[model samples]
Target: MGLTHEFFLLRSESDDEPVEQVVLSDNLVLYIWDSFRWIPAFNPSTKENHVGLNYHGITLIRHEGANLLKDICLSWSSLFSLAPSTLQLTGDFVMDENGNGRYEKLNFTRDDLTKPLTTLAAIADRAFLENYIIVHHGI
Candidate 1:
């Protein structure tokens, strides 16, 4: 199989609750609760970073109607680093409920500004885990 990328979000069927946008790609899986504005992007080996346009908070909580949302949320964060030209993933994970998450490394390289910035790309198909702890905490 080849490397695949996708964007996702967890939303409530009712309007009384807030929606959660989730992003699971390779060794990184981010959960944004629509409050902190900080979407998490993690790499099992190199580093993990969250992407957002602004810096709100690392977490957010919303209580609307008769429902309460108590889950990991990212808000109020900005993508300070320009989108990396590449990503280097060093692990594998099942980030989705249906067991469709990808695991690998991404190499992010800088571009020469004049070449029409190349679309960011990631490398997949490698497994480099320190142990079960890496999978559990995902730090």
Candidate 2:
């Protein structure tokens, strides 16, 4: 089985009744997971409600972290090189029975995922504005 990551927007970190799910492909989430990290100054773990973005947990991005996260999402175009490995990604950890990295096959360029990534960036911008909190539910 493969893993997936889900994103959500919340008015308050404490409020769970209303969370807007940010639609994005699991492939995009998994692709970016390896490089995603906290900005240290944020010291996310020091917060009671925060958690590190991991393969099996939830993570929260607030204020400055939101802005930094936006930057990270926006830079994915050049941050990764999946073009050549899209069709035939070969590696024991990557290749599945189908001969592709679980969902690592990037049949299209980052251009295809740019829109959703941009959308996430926009949501992060909102989080920076204190209008929302970015919640990443990882698989």
Candidate 3:
């Protein structure tokens, strides 16, 4: 009924196609939107512009981006005292400076952000440790 993100984890290190998929909550998608570059999940439908599908798509996160995200998440972990319980999720996903964010209130924790963050990190770590091609999917 609403837009959400899907994180596809590659089942094999040698495989580019993902066998498992995760649909992230819409609110978490918005809260963590700023952490990602958006290009990770490349969808042709939104070549010019789109939100749901884009946020709803699973993009790739290169090592650099993943590293940055890891660092950011670390900072967030340090910054927030409640671990994840205090991580307020405001569903204003359509990030517009002019105040166009919809579904703007929820006490949801970082469960949404945590999953992607871990997934992205795993992708990066595995690529590095296993010595494989790490082309990111568009997140």
Candidate 4:
């Protein structure tokens, strides 16, 4: 099976509240491999970097509506170091009865001139996560 990433939105700091979850693209594995370098290898046999252990945190807005999802996308784009002008967000989403949300499709585009390969790759990672959560979680 391919590597898969999961994203979750916690309703509160306490674990009692339900959580929102989604499955992200496996392409994130490749992006992480290309973007970061591992270090201090004792031997070639055991030198592979583990992509599954990597994690990144992004803050979400506290608003109670679709704007929360938009804020998440914007925040994720910023985390990837994407310039505002280069990042474009377009999509539709819906929230379920249980307060879970998913995107019908969240599309993001960036101007090549304004982004480097690493940034572009990271953007893909962020976009995939954002889209996956929006589609599966109902946001």
Candidate 5:
């Protein structure tokens, strides 16, 4: 059986709105999981949002195994130039009863999630939405 887990969504302050469109609020979400890969609950929170110059965000999947990831999926605009003007990530690591290393919870921080894909608009020419989707990279 899989282990229990949780998820969180963190909003950052470095958004990509024009100087005239900047908003100063941050938001985040956390999703809890059960042994069968089902989300039992979720939590959301808010903060100041802006903490750096280059925007950052991350995704964490707590699976029953041992592994680490270096990359994740983002909207083409997020990779390019869009509403996501900032990014940051903070997560935790632990071992489950099965002796597998996993993340109990994940934290993601972005300026915005619904930004348009202006930079990688060209990418759409080669792939569909399924091509860029982010799935759990279990270990």
Candidate 6:
């Protein structure tokens, strides 16, 4: 069907703080098919299933107390591009303007996921959490 990935801030394994995880899915085939009324087709020239989509893998940044920040997921096509740095920068701005003056935690919602690329960019831009250890998953 599709791949599902999650990112979250985790406290110590022994700590009691609840992990606030954000989840995203890669369902581009479905999205494009429904949104554009077109289905993916095989490219005889390339000998590949041509959906013309590229997806970002999930990554995590860890901090003291075992806390973590999930990097953003992204996708791109010949006509469109979504970058991790972009999301990271946006997240930094969102935090500066609306976050609680701290980068210790980040939050997002399902509605945010309706636009996964933009949302992940916002999360990655969390500049305050720069010191955390980065963990990559599902590459």
Of the pair 3 and 6, which is ahead by TM-score? 3
Candidate 4 lDDT over residue span 25-123, tens digit each: 344333333332221111113344232223342222222222333343344445655445444333346788999987644233443222333333343
Provide the clashing-pair count of each candidate structure: 25, 0, 15, 9, 14, 5
Using TM-score as the yardstick, the better of models 1 and 5 is 1
On residues 1-139, what C-alpha lDDT tens digit does candidate 5 reach at each position? 1231121211222322211111211222122111112211111123222221111232222221101111111232244343234554333577888999966543333434223122112222222322221122111
lDDT score, residue 116, model 5? 19
Regions more than 4 Å wrong, model 6: 10-20, 28-59, 62-114, 127-139
For all predicted structures, in order, the TM-scores are 0.22, 0.65, 0.50, 0.25, 0.16, 0.29
Candidate 1 lDDT over residue span 1-139, tens digit each? 2322232121321232322222233223332224323323333233433332122212211112001111121111123134455534345454777877776453433332111111111000001111100111111
Residue 22's lDDT within candidate 1 is: 26
Sort the predicted structures by TM-score, highest score first. 2, 3, 6, 4, 1, 5
- Cand. 5 TM to true fold: 0.16
Worst 10 residues of 1 by lDDT: 122-131
Q: Which wins on TM-score, candidate 1 or candidate 4?
A: 4
Q: After superposition, which runs of candidate 4 have C-alpha atoms over 4 Å from their true positions?
A: 29-139
Error of 3 at 35 (Å): 2.3
Number of the predicted model whose TM-score against the real structure is largest: 2
* Candidate 1 vs 6: which has more TM-score: 6
lDDT: which candidate is best?
2
* lDDT digits (tens) for residues 20-93 of candidate 3: 44455555555655665432333344443221224433344433343454465445434443565645545554
